[model samples]
Structures are given as structure tokens and as C-alpha cells.
Target chain A: MIVDSLPRTTLTEIAGMAGGGAALPALAARLNIVEMTQAAEDAVLQPKDAGRWPHALRAALAARIARQNDCPALADRYAGMAGADMAVADPAVAGEAEGLTLVCRFMDKVSVSPRDVAARDILELQEAGVSDADIVRLCELNAFVSYQVRVIAGLRLMAESVA
Target chain B: MNDVIHKFTRNVPDWRPRVTPVKLEDATPEQLDALQVTPSNTKVSAYVLTLAHDVETLKVRSPLFNGIMYDPGGLDRAARELSALAASVLSRCVYCAAVHAARHAQLSKSTEVTDDLFANGDKADLTPRDRAIFDLAYGLAGSPPAATPDQMRAARDAGLSDAEIVDAILSSALFGWANRLMHVLGDPVRKGAA
Candidate 1:
């Protein structure tokens, strides 16, 4: 929806620029995005998480995501992976493009019609007895920030227990 | 609503509210005044970081959400107003809903869309773009599991970019947090109901 409303040429140009493929290696090297990605996958998939490996790995990922403003496409790839679709449902290269396209559409709609109730959401969590500080900390979770609405809501629940 | 409600129950073992539903005429001016404010306890930092992400989303990723938060060059103001409207309604925050409803009227040369957003939640007759946004708001506010691959694909078919989609998701997530805060603090004051 948001995508449809945007200038097609702009989307094309952006896609083309990203597809030039120069940024991937740079991104992979700069943040160890590739290694981090692997580590994250292992941490999530393996047992005995006990919150150690996952915590360290997430901290690493969060750092990279914080710098997402510099290279949105790369950020898009990583954030998108973390957000909704982690990898192409189909293994084909075209599937990745299609997946990216789907992510783009979803993001456009959200960006356009964002929820402006940060104050209220926090209050609800706190009214439920979550602490003010913990509420703030939960909001810092990049997964919650990047489109994981359930994760955000879950964070509120998690915060309630800790707070 | 039930899931969020359940989440609260599971999290707060000792939490109990000081509920006091005052009648309109009996309510103190202070209570009514507080309704208009975002509240000191509301997490401002969370709001700021999410807004910053939204700015980056628009500037580098997609034009759809580029100017929603701030507008120097003036772009997407109407759409932003629409977003604000959707955000408030889904949030069920009386204060935010009223404010953004007025904003939608001021920005648009019409009131039909705003009216729809008020009367209907995600079922409003909006453009494909706004519709997608509405869907996101509902998912973010109510049940996020509803944001399945189908929902994602619908937006994609409608032409959204990866950047824009991520922005939208972040925005929805941000507001979801915001709405919960507002609701927990207190309901908003109606235009002149107090």
C-alpha cells in the first residue's frame, strides 16, 4: 500500500543501487553481520540457552541494528530477517527478492500508519504493575522496535515479571 | 485484547489498580487536565528512539513514512495524519484519538477518512496504502500473530518496499507500546465531556 503510493522510479533506483552488491561484503565485514547472524541462529535453535548465548548474541545484533540508519538496505536485510521473514521461504534467488518485496510492502504500510500511543502502551503495562524503568528497557529491545509487535507485547509481559 | 490482558495477569502477581470512576461533573479539574497530558511517567526515550527509526525509514528507505514525524520539506503530511488517526483508534487512547482525528481533518481537504477511522477500526474504506497501515495497527495493538505472511504479501502486492515495511512494523510496534502506557495511566477526557 505505501509502496504503491510511492514513486516507482524511486523504488527501482534504490533496489538497483542495493543490487549492485557492493554493500553486502562491506556490511558482512564491518559488523561481522554474517557471523553474528550464524551465532544468533545457533543460539536460538540450540538448547540450554539459559539466556547466556542469546543475550550476548542479541547485544551484538542490537549494536549493528543501531547503526542501521547508515545503510538501510543492509539494515533492511538484517532487520527484516529479525522482524518477520528471516529467510526466503523459497530457496531461489528470486524468492529472496520476492521476500524483500513483501517486507517492503509491510514496512511501507506501518511507516505510513504508525501507532502513536507510546504513552498509553507504557501506562497499560505499568498499570498492570510493570515498573516505569523496566518499561523503558523493554522498549529498547530492537526486535520489538523492528516490527515484532508480539515481541513488544511479550516484552511488556516479561518486564512485568522482572519489575 | 485478551492476550494482552492475559499477559498483564501473568506478569503482575501483586498488581492491583486504584480504580475510581468519577462521574463527569464530580471529577476534579486536575484529573481532567491530566487526561490531556502524555504523563510524566510515560517513557519518552522509547518514543524518541522509535521516532528516530521512523525518520531513517522515510529518508533512506521509503517515501511513504519519510515525513510523518517531522516535516521541513513537507511530504506525506496527509498520510502521516492518517497514520496518527489509525494509531490512536487502535490504541483506544481517548486523548490521542481526539487529537489525531482533528489533525486528519486539518491536513486533508476532507473528513470522511477520519470519520471512518473513528467509526471503523481496520475496516475503514481507505486507500490500499492506508488499509495496509490499518491492518498493521490492528495487529500491533491487538494480536500480533495475525501479521502472517499473507498480510505481508498483501502489502507487497500493493507495492511496498522492504524499508517501508520495516518502518511500518516499527511504527506499529512503537504505538502498541504507547497505547498500553496511556490506557494503563488513565482514559482520555472527551472534548467537553468533563
Candidate 2:
């Protein structure tokens, strides 16, 4: 919900999805990694695991993190999707108390500083009605976002030098 | 088969994470298949079993991991492992750090670099070439904002081909996220309980 859009060029617009950097091989590599990322997101956010974690919840949590990380493009898309299903976002609209609050809280830890998280922190999620499977999915989603944000940001940096 | 098959153990238990992984007896058929063997057809390890708690995601995760680490087109296994170690070091993930460090030493057969890296990655004994991976990956993993073109240039200066550098970024970024998951899912123990 707090995800604000920032103006920028998307990788696809810049390089036809794989955006070239200085070298052909480097460009290929970035494109390959980006393709994997796109595929992974489609798998996670689409119809596959709907029974466990809804697409909406995934969107909300994803948007929250993209916002936290300053990924405007990703934040805008996921936040828009999350808007419909946020039946009861926290007072801060930050995903508290709702089963998602637990996800948001934990993932926020993951986003800011993962080293500080302890077993007790995970237990709080379990107590909040998140199953072990859901917990794993949350971790997967959060971690993937971390990877995605960094890769894109780094690639964006590489893209700037593109001709 | 991956060496992790033989190396899996809960020995280095940390009291920090408390989620119980699905043990062998409780594993599902899907997990049974997944935990049964490594890519090389050797017996799988407790690590796979532990991950069986969420077999579906593991189904999705393992192949990607294999592609990045074991796929044909990227950095050699040693350089890939080096990138992983750099990220794990940044995440301060003991479990992953231990696993990848051993792999780096085995693949490179260069104990001095591996040991120095493990001891203090901030200043490993690598030449500018090898050091490029550390520079690029540390910033990439710790804080993407901190990562800059210089890190990539540094990797290039160290004599890594563009593809190698790409692999370096991919592997390091993978661990940046992965280390976080491992940290929350469970803590690493030095040895399994006897």
C-alpha cells in the first residue's frame, strides 16, 4: 500500500527484456538471469500455489517489499494487485495482525537485516496462523524479491553504460 | 552427486530457529523422490529432507539452483562457489558459509584463498582477478544500493570474462536471498546430535 512509483526505464524497454551492457556475453548473462526471474515470478504469483498462499497476499507482501527496497516498477504493479484483497491491513497499512501482518513483519526483517532474525521471530508467524508450508513460501517469496530487486538494480546500473 | 548428500547433518544446531524440518520418516512420496538422490544419482542428504517441509517450492527451487550452480554456460564451479561464499559472508549465514566455503576449497584446491576468505572476506588473499568477485558480490548482496558499476568493472579488471562476471552476479545474488531464507528457516549446527 505504501509502494510509491518512481520514474525510470524498465529493462525490457531498454534492451528488449535482456538489456545489453558493455559486452555481448554480459548482456546475454543478464538477459538469461532476468528471464529466469520473470519465469519464477509467474510461477509463484499465478495459479500454481493458490491453495496455500493467495495471489493477492503474495502481491501485497511483494509490493510492500518492493516499496521498502525502492523498486518502483515492481512496487507499482504488485501494490495495485494487493489493493483489492487488503481486507484488513494494519493501522499502518503495513500488514500487521492479519495473517499477512506476520508475513509482512518477518519479510520486513528479511528486507532490512536478515542476520538479526531469530527462531523466536519465526515462531511468531506460526502463532499467527501461518503454516509451515506457508512460512516456507513466504521465505521463498521474500528471498526471491531480495534477489530480484538486487539483480535488477545492479543490471540497471550496468545498463546505464549501454550505447 | 552433490557432496551435500554425505555432508548433511544437524550437528551445528543453533537455538535461534525452531522450525522442525520434515525428517526422513515423515517425508512424502514427492519428498522421498527428491531426498533420495543427488543429481549424480548418489544418496541425498538431510538437507534435502529438511527442505521437504515444502516440497513444491523445493521442486521449483532445486532446478533453478542446479541451473545457476551446475548449469553449463556460466562461471566454473569454483568461481561460482566463490561468489556464493562472498554473499553468504555478507549475510553472516553460518550454515551456507560453511557449505560453500568447503566447496570453494575443493573446487579451487586453493586452501590459502579459501581459508583467508573464510577468516576475513573483507580482505581475502586473492589477486585483483579473484578479488573482483568479492568486491562485486559483497555490495550486490549486502545492499544493492551500494553496488555500482565499479564492482563490475573490478570483476572485469580481475580478468573475468563478461559471462563469468554475470555468473558471479547471479550466484552472489542467489545467496543474498537464499542466505536469508536459510537463516530464518533454521540455524546451522556444526554437527548432528549423536
Candidate 3:
């Protein structure tokens, strides 16, 4: 349904995905648009289930750490725990989780300039004592010279660790 | 480390597709600069200038033309959705990943979905249709050559229409060029800025 409504660019993109129309357009065009639209509209109107798998993913991650301890079974069992809703009680955990969610959510949007280096590299460089100012300077100079941001960031990290 | 290599992969070339880095900075004064390459008899600076023009076109056309095209008008959302589309492209873009990731979250109106996006681009909490959109974008952005017939079958099974599918390809291609420029020229002005 949503597919029916999207413009040609998006459609072409989707078509391109199926391996460029000469191959897949016949099948894609044959899809039942009317039925699909109804299903999507209904889905959007329904209420959401908040306490879902996000925390479960984290728990599973946490469980891996906990497994080294004596209570492996208990740790593993707890790892499967579902993520609680933000509206539910525990303010502190909720607050931190919310913040983390925002960071992650923010990541979903913009296409970062691949020219810049990884942030992890910058963070590491900072740890090694290369000032933030120098890192910023490098980024600017590299921009002018058309240097890769990833390399620049990596160098900063290396410089910091060495410094 | 090979920062330049890190920024551009075989799928995407540097700003001047034909020009090498050494050629860009070291060519004689009479020789054309990297930014100067363009089709003859045109004032445009080839790749970079073309992008600047198209981005403006996308902005205006998205509102006027694409507005009427989609029933509810998804172009703004589409632009906003470009963030999500971008996240999938920026794996090589250390500078771009977080920015697009953040925009993806804002469009979805949920932190949870956004986080899921970074953890997994196509597998994020998008609707089936949108997922189809993401998958299409991913295939185009990642490996245009290998994006074979079977890949389109997957999208069809996922429920993208012929038209929507076409749009998805255009969006991905637009990003293909857009991502390269941003990667090369430096947009978002900051690593984390969405």
C-alpha cells in the first residue's frame, strides 16, 4: 500500500533493488497493491507494543559477560528478559535507556560525510592527549586538501596514543 | 592508515571518478584541477557542481512534484527518510554514520527504532514496505553490479510495487552520488551532527 503511494524515484529505487526492471519488474508490478495497502493502513492504526526486544538484545549481551560467573543458567535466563517500557517504574534505568535510544535513533537518520574519520578514533586520540583543537584543525585542513576523514581520524587516534 | 581507501570503496569512487588523488593535487597549472573536470562547453564543475544543482532540484521538486505523486506526500518524510537510507551507506563513512543514524531516529519518532537502525540498517523496525525500500537502497548502494534479479524478487516478496521500486532505485542512486560528495566534500559539517 505505502509502495503504491510513493513517487517514482522511490519506486525506481525499489525496482532497482529487485535487480533492475528488465529482470524483476514483471513480478513486482503484478503484486496486489489494493490488498497490501489495506493491510498497511490497518497496521499503522494499531497500538504499538512497547516492552519489546530492545532490552532482550542488551540482556543477551549482558548475559555473555555474566556466563563466566558461577550462575551461568541464571545469567542466561535473565539475559532473555524482555525490555521494560519507558512508562514503567524505574526512572534511572529508563532515563539512561531513553538517552541511549535517542543516540541510536539519531544515528538512523543523517548520512554522515564518509570523508570524516570515525569518532572512536577521535575519542582514542583524545585519551592519548592530542587536544580536540588539533583534531578539529586536522579535519579542516584535510577537508581543504580532500583527505579522507577516516584516515584523519585514525591518525588522530594513533597520534593521541603515542603522545 | 589508508584513510582515502577507507572513505571510498570500489562501489563508490572519489569525487572525480576518473581523477586520482595524486593527479588532483599535483597536476600543472595548465592542467585542469579535480573540481574543474566537466563535459565540454558547460560551465558546471562536473560532479560537484552537478550535485549542488540536483540537491536544489530534489528540494524543490520533492515538494512540488513528488508532493502530488504520493497520496499522503512522503517526500519530506522521504528527505527525512534519507537519513535512514544514508545510515546504510555510511558504514565506510566514519564521519557520516552517526549523523544519518540520528536522522533515521527523528523520522521514525522513536529512539528504539533508531537504535535498531544503527545495529542493523535494513533490519531496523521499518514497516515491511519501508524495509523493502531499505533493502533496495542497500543493494543499490552496496553492490549495484551484484543486485541481480533474485534481489528484486526478495523486494517483491517483501511487497514493494513496480513504481515504488523504481523510486527506491533513484533514491539509492541519488544517495550514491550524494554520499560520495558528502564523503569527499564534508557535509553535516560535523561528525555527529545529524
Candidate 4:
């Protein structure tokens, strides 16, 4: 697929893979993966059935994860999509006012120190009245952003190598 | 009840979800479709059923996962498994590490690499090639992604093609997605054994 037509949120665009930026010939072999990645971003960030988490909140969380990964460009993009939840895009802003203090803590731990997450973490969420399904929804959002941030970072490193 | 496995091991352990999995009988049409619950294939793992709560992401992720890992002709299967293991180990996702480590051993037809990995971790003794691949994947798996141009050069110097390097990135990044789900949503345990 042509790079121009690719979604702006895609790694191809976010990592500057187009226009002589990391456009390795091998990338063509995985066009399907690229496209599916955009589709995944949509599914996670703006799904038709967003469950308890609104699209804006998901976008804020996505930005927060991107920032934690130090991908400012990607974080900026997600922050733009956050709308009213934009404050939460800043990792420093605890989501307490938004009634998301536990959610934010859970997301931060899962994103930065996943190894330390334990059964008690899930128990805390459940105790706070977060449903089982909402917990799953939060995880999918956090997990997808983690994947996206790494891919963009990897692509940028690839670009730098070729440059 | 079962004891959660704290340390990494090559033997794949049972995954126990901290949250309740969606009951098969109560699944909606969309959840059922995403789960691919055919009459012939009714047995879904708790991990997958738990994911069915967000069927939209689950649907797209399943295919993207298979395409990255199982699609032919980029990085070799064993090498892809190695990348996956690198990410899982860094994330400390015991379930993911075990499954991918076993696959790496099976595909490479040797346990030496995984055994060393489980023993020495990031300091695992490896060939120049495996070291380059593991280092790249491990760096990429970090929160701030520490992989540098030098590491990319090392991979090329180790004789990895651009295609292989891309595959390494994808396989490792894919686990960045998988590890959070498996490690956060559940525990790896010895089923039926305390």
C-alpha cells in the first residue's frame, strides 16, 4: 500500500517510514502487518464497542503510555485525540479527579513495571467496583499502546541506522 | 487452587485468569465470532475467553499476531521465537517466556540457548548472531525502548538482512502486546497442584 494513504497514527507515518525515512525494501513484504496494525489502533483506541472506557479516555491513556515510553511524537498524536480527557494524557496528572486514580495507577504499573503487577493489583480494581470486562478492556488498551510505542521506537532506530 | 510460578522455566505452565472468563454458553454473536467458536472447536483457553470481553481488539490482534509470527519468509521461525523470548523474559511474563522458550528450543532443535537464558538472563551466553538479535529485541522491549543505531549496526554486522531485522522488531513488539495481557491478566501456575 502507498505510504501517503496510510493512517497518520500508523508506525509508517509516526516513525517517518515514508519519503526516504526508513523505507527499507523489506517493509513492503509486511504491508499487511502495517495495515493490520492501524486497524488494531482503531480497535483499541476507538472501537465501535468501547465498553466502559470512552474513546477519549482510551486516547488519554494511549498518550500516557506513549509518553512513558518517551515517544513524544506519538504521545502528542494521542493527546490530540483525548478531547476532555487531555489532562490525563500527562502522566503526572493523577486521574483522581476523573475517578480514575486506581485506573491510572494500574496502567502506570502495567506499562512501566509489568513484572511487578500481581493478583493484588487485579483485586484492587475489582474491589473498587471495576468490572471484570472493564479490567480486560483497560488491559487491551494498555497492551496495544505498549506495542505501538515500541514499534515506533524500533522503526526510528532502523531509520537512524540507514541514515 | 494452584501455586503461581514465580521463576522462569522452559516447561509451559497453565494460565489462570485473575478475572472471570466469558462463559462459552453466554457469548454474544460478536464474541462468538471473534472467538471462532465452531462446533468442532469449542475449547477456548481462559486467556482468549477473557479477551473476548473486548472482542473488537481481540479479533484484529489474533490475525496480526499470526501474520507476524507464523507468516512465511522473513525471519526464520526459530529466530522469531528467540525475539519473542527476549521480550517475554524482559517483561518477566512467565507464561509467555515459557511458551516462546519451548518453541525456540523445539525449532532450533536444542535447549542450550533457552537453558542459558533461563540461567543467566540478559547475560546468557550466545553466539554473535543470537546475541545481536537478543540485544536488539531486549532493548526494544524496554519502556523507553533503549535500542540504538549501534545495536542495529551490530545486527547487520551479524549478517541479519533488513528483512530479518524487521521481523525481529515485529516479533519482539508483538510480545510487548502479549506479555501485558498474559502477565497482567493472569498467573502461570501448576494446574491442580498447590
Candidate 5:
């Protein structure tokens, strides 16, 4: 499980800042935010009710997003949770074998070019028979992964600066 | 027909969800808890209702969002708003941009910064500090997160303390999360049009 790999220290494992005590002080002041961030990661990646997307699929998507953002360590951590759905973690796979080509395309667009997304994108999903609830679930997963990627990137920069 | 707003504005736009929102009457106990709906606070926006479909994330996301954007100290409110606005602009999340821009203008007590931003985008003329903050946020909001050590140094040189810089990262990164849901799940249309 993704939660199993989480470090006890706030923002340390996710941001790959272990042994760097410099950024700890700044992070300690906002410990609530840090803790809540972990809670959010759990909620999105492995929610009690995962809706249409299972935990393994969510982890694959999370790993894919992390790679898209060039965060290999974070990607590797999530990849461990991907189980049998690991091929979906590669951006070049296109998800055809998994019957998720459309889903993959939608996620790629939303992740890299959200501004270009429009009503038609949702329409296509609807036409493909994806439920409204499932659509929301997919988006929450994609959105949370996007947020996590940037936070990891930012935290690394913070650690580097203070180091 | 109500027009979908394509340009950046301080006038907040209404968000119309493409998916069916969870009806309040049909909401499960868990969804109600996530929505935080009390009798006195029964009113909820369409956006919130749409998000109620994924109650787990909604539950934790709300508190984390508030802590990053509204917690005392760290980055000043206006600076945090600026970081949010920068991310919104980069993602072209019109609804998020307008709302944060308005908040930024209100907090700063002037439209000068948002006005310049709306008119010129990344080339908007800003005070050195605002420039550094905006640039850092814009870079961090990119798909691969283009923020570099130089931008971090620029923010420091612009007088932002470490705490303030961390706040900027959180606010901007929070919007990176927000923009996908807002821009991808719905359309930003004129008020009452949907």
C-alpha cells in the first residue's frame, strides 16, 4: 500500500529530503498542513470507497503523473503500489492493452495541458459510458497527483536552498 | 445563451459542472459530513456539490487548502493569493483565476497588479518582489514544474523569508491541484447562465 511506504517525518519521504535537517524547521511550523497532505494522499490514492478506479489503478496513475513531472523518486514510491497495473505507469504505454486508451489520453491532456481541455473532453467520456461519479473520481485522482508532484518538486527546491 | 469566459477577469465567473452534482437530498451521511452542511449552512455551490461525488478527498482537501491559503503568518495573505493567481493563470483555470484575482485585488487594496497581469500575462509589469513571487509560482505550476534554484534565489533576494517561500510553494501547488478539477470538470460561464 502507498501509505505503508510513507515516512514518519512530515514531507520527508514524499519530498525525498531524508537526512536534510535544514528544511525541517520551516516544515515543522506548518506541521498540520504536512499531516493533512498525507491524509489527502491516502484519501485520493487509496480511499475506503475508491469508486470505479481501484487502489492499484490509482497508484499506476499516480506514478505516471509523478514521472510526467520528472520526480522519479516519488514515481518509484507510487509504482510499488501499482500491483499488476504497473504497465499503465509508463506514459508511452497508451493503455490500449488495458482498454484505457481514452482514459489515458484524457489524463495526459488534463495533466499537461489542462487549459486546452474543454466541454468536449467530458462529453467524450460520457459518450464512452463512463459514469459521472467515475469521471469525478478520475479527476480527483489526476488532480491530487498533479498537486503532489509539484509539492514534491517545491519541497526539494526548499531543501536544496536551505542546505 | 450565457457565454463561457475565455479571458482573465477580476469579475468572478460561475462554474457549471459537466457532470451531475450529488443532490443534497440523496447525499449519504459521509457526503453530508464532507460537505459540512448544517441547517444554518445548507447553502452550497454547484462546484462543491460536484466535488461531493468524491467525498474522501473533499473531506481532507478542504482543511489542507484552508491551512495553506489562510493560516496565520508564513506568507502574507496577498502574497499567497498572488501565488494562487499565478498558478490559475498558467493553468488557464478561468474561474480560479477570477476568484483569486479579485481576492488579491481586495487584499492589496488596488487593481494595479491584477490589471497588469490580465493585460500582459507573464510580461506583466510588477514590483520586483511581486515579479519574483509570480515568476516562481508560474514556473512551479508547469507540468514538469520548471521552478529552478535561481527562481528560489530570486524570491529570497526579493526579501521573502524561508517561511514565506514555503507558503508560496504550497499556495501555488494547491492551485495546481485545484485547476485540474475546476478547469477540467466544468465550464466557467457567466453567472446564472447554467
Candidate 6:
């Protein structure tokens, strides 16, 4: 929730100022990162993935982790995706709940104490039927989210300094 | 202080990765595109290739990353490398720590400086400007993240411009993520090993 307390006008101005000049290149790079983040989220929640994991369930897990990490913005974003009416009845969630939860647990661990992630953690995912491909994707998402948190934190710090 | 830095001093890898990488031939189209081909057709490092498992993210990651770490403006190469090393060392990612440590040495042209930093960052022999940068980098790498306001003051007092400070933030922050990725993805092994 790094963006939560900021004025919408100021943010718009920041976005606007990024349109041209020396800032343009950096802005474009940041915008691309934003798009990439969106794309990854979309891929994770896309219908094709519904068979393996429901978007809502995944979002719920993300929301829970975001809340734990004190990222109000991310928490809110994920909670919205999780939706008001949520349950584990979806076969994807019911069947692979353990695997999914483990991924969530891994995200939580990596968010703070990344060094603690042991070989056993990866092994457990494999034992639970999470394919190597899935494990890789999970790591990617976890890694990206961890990056996102710091990036946002840094940006917020920058913004606060200017403000 | 010595306990904080990575213990590896020599026998670093020549061109080998610590972990099993996704071979280029096995890469997806997106992953293939993630490779940064130079005039001679060289590509990104083995570490990046291993990240091909998620090319959608890598595409954006590459550009933002290049801009922050390798772009020609803002903090000088040595200072940025110092920021990178500070973060990598504290994060305890031996792979990235070594890369940046070597780069810092090469750019600064002082092996002893790099050695001092790796041995004990806080006590590293540094100029006033370098000390300021290190303070911020170490602060950012702290568990709860050192106080931003104070670090900013220290940087400004040490004579860094806003843009330079931004570079410091970006350099250190990128490694915050990078180190975690290396730690989770695979191990960093010594060269000539089975």
C-alpha cells in the first residue's frame, strides 16, 4: 500500500512529468516494469490456469501474505481480486490446496528471510505434485513480488523526500 | 564485521554458474528474446538465462534493470558497484557479492579497497563521498531498512546530488531482489568443480 496515502493529483503529476525529457527514458522503463507485473498477474489468473489454480484463491493467498508483510496497497489489490464471496470449493483449490499454500508460505518466507529457504522447502513442493515448471513460476512470482515491495518502498521514500 | 561478508576470496568461477541453468537451446521464444546479444552476438549472463522460466517478467525486468545498473548516467561506475556490493554482501548472496566486488575493484582500481569492503564494510577505508554512499547502502540493506530520512541527510551532507542519491537507492534496491533470486534459484559454486 505504498501509494495509499499519496494524493492522487501528485501521483498524476509525477506520471505526467514522466512523459518527456531526461525523465522519459527512466519513466518508460518503469512503465514497462508495471506492464510486465500486470502481465504476470494476468497470466497467473487467466482462465487456462483455472484448472490448476483459481484466480481468486491465488489472490486470496497473495492478499494474506501482503497483509502479513504490511503492504496495504498490495494487500488491498489482492483482496479485491480474492472477492467478497470466496471459498475453497473450487476443485483446483480443494485438490491442490496444500501445494498452493506451500507456495504462499514460500512467498512469505522469501519476503523477509530469504536465506531461510532450504532445499527441503523446494523438495516439499515437488513431493506435493508441484511440477518443476510450476516451482519455477512460483519462484519467479515470489521473487518479483519481493522485488516489487522494495521498489515500491524505495519510490515511496523518494516521494516522501520530495514532498 | 568480518563475519558479515562472504568468505570467498579466490577460486571464483571463470564462467560457470553455481546452479544448473536452463540451457539456451531449451529456452522458450520469450526467453530467447531475453538474451542480450551484443555485436559479437554474446548474450546475458548464465544467471539471467536461468530466470527464463518466467520470460514475461524478465522482459520488463531486463530494461528497468539495465537502466538502473548499467546506464551511463548518475553515480559513477565504482560508486554504483559499491552500492551493489553492499547490498549483495549484506543479503549474503555470494554470487552477486563476488560479481559486484570484482567490478568494484576493477572500476575503482584498488583491490585493497574491495578487500576492505568485503572484510568489513563499515570499516572499509573510504573517502568522505564513498563513506556517505556506503552509509546509505548499508542502511537500506538493514533488516528493517535503516531510517530513510537520516540516510538521505547523510548522503546530502556527504555532497551527493539528488540524482546520485537516486542511483544509490536503485543500485542497492535492485540487489535486494537480485540476491534473493540467486539465493532461491540455485547455488553459486566454485569453478572447475564437478
Query: lDDT winner among the candidates?
Result: 4
Q: State each model's CA lDDT, in order.
A: 0.37, 0.66, 0.35, 0.91, 0.89, 0.60
Q: Where is model 4 more than 4 Å wrong at Cα?
A: A1-9
Alpha carbon deviation, residue B166, candidate 1 (Å): 3.2
lDDT score for candidate 6 against the true structure:
0.60
Higher lDDT: candidate 3 or 6?
6
Interface RMSD of each: 14.2, 2.5, 20.0, 1.1, 1.1, 3.8
Model 5 reproduces what portion of true contacts? 0.84
TM-score of chain A of 3: 0.20
Q: How would you encode candidate 6's per-residue C-alpha lDDT over A1-163 as one tens digit per residue?
A: 1222222222223233323332333333344344544454455444343434456766665555445445566656666777632432221343243445666566666656776665567677778877655665566555554445454455555555552
Q: lDDT per residue, candidate 1, B1-194, as tens digits?
A: 11122111101122122122233344235433322224464332222322222221212222222222342322245554454455556645554455556666767777788777666656778888777656654554543324545555555566654434434543454444344333443334322322
- Give the 10-residue window scoring lowest on summed lDDT in candidate 6 chain B: B1-10
Residue A114 in model 4: shift from native, Å?
0.5
lDDT per residue for candidate 5 within A1-163, as digits (tens), equals 1121323643567676544445555666777887898898899889999877999999999898889989888888889999999999998889999999999999999998888998989999999999999899999889988887887788888778763
- Model 6, range B99-176, lDDT digits (tens) per residue? 888888888788876787777757888888888888788667654455377666767788876667767876786776
- The digit string of per-residue lDDT tens for model 3 on B32-100 reads 332344457334333333222222222222232222223342223543354335433543553344445
TM-score result, candidate 6: 0.74
Where is model 1 chain A poorest over a 10-residue stretch in terms of lDDT? A1-10
Query: In model 5, where do residues sit more than 4 Å from their true spots?
Result: A1-10
Off by over 4 Å in 2: A1-35, A85-93, A97-99, B1-17, B23-46
Question: Per-residue lDDT for A1-163 in model 1, tens only?
Answer: 1112212221222333223322222221212212232332232223132222133323333323323323243334344344333332221222244334332222222222233433344445446564443332333233323323232332222223221
> What is every candidate's C-alpha DockQ against the true complex, given to 2 decimals?
0.07, 0.43, 0.03, 0.80, 0.74, 0.27
Docking class of 1: incorrect
RMSD list, candidates in order: 16.4, 7.0, 21.5, 1.8, 3.4, 6.5
Order candidates by lDDT, high to low.
4, 5, 2, 6, 1, 3
lDDT of 5 at B21: 97
lDDT: the better of candidates 5 and 6: 5
Candidate 3, residue A70: Cα displacement in angstroms equals: 56
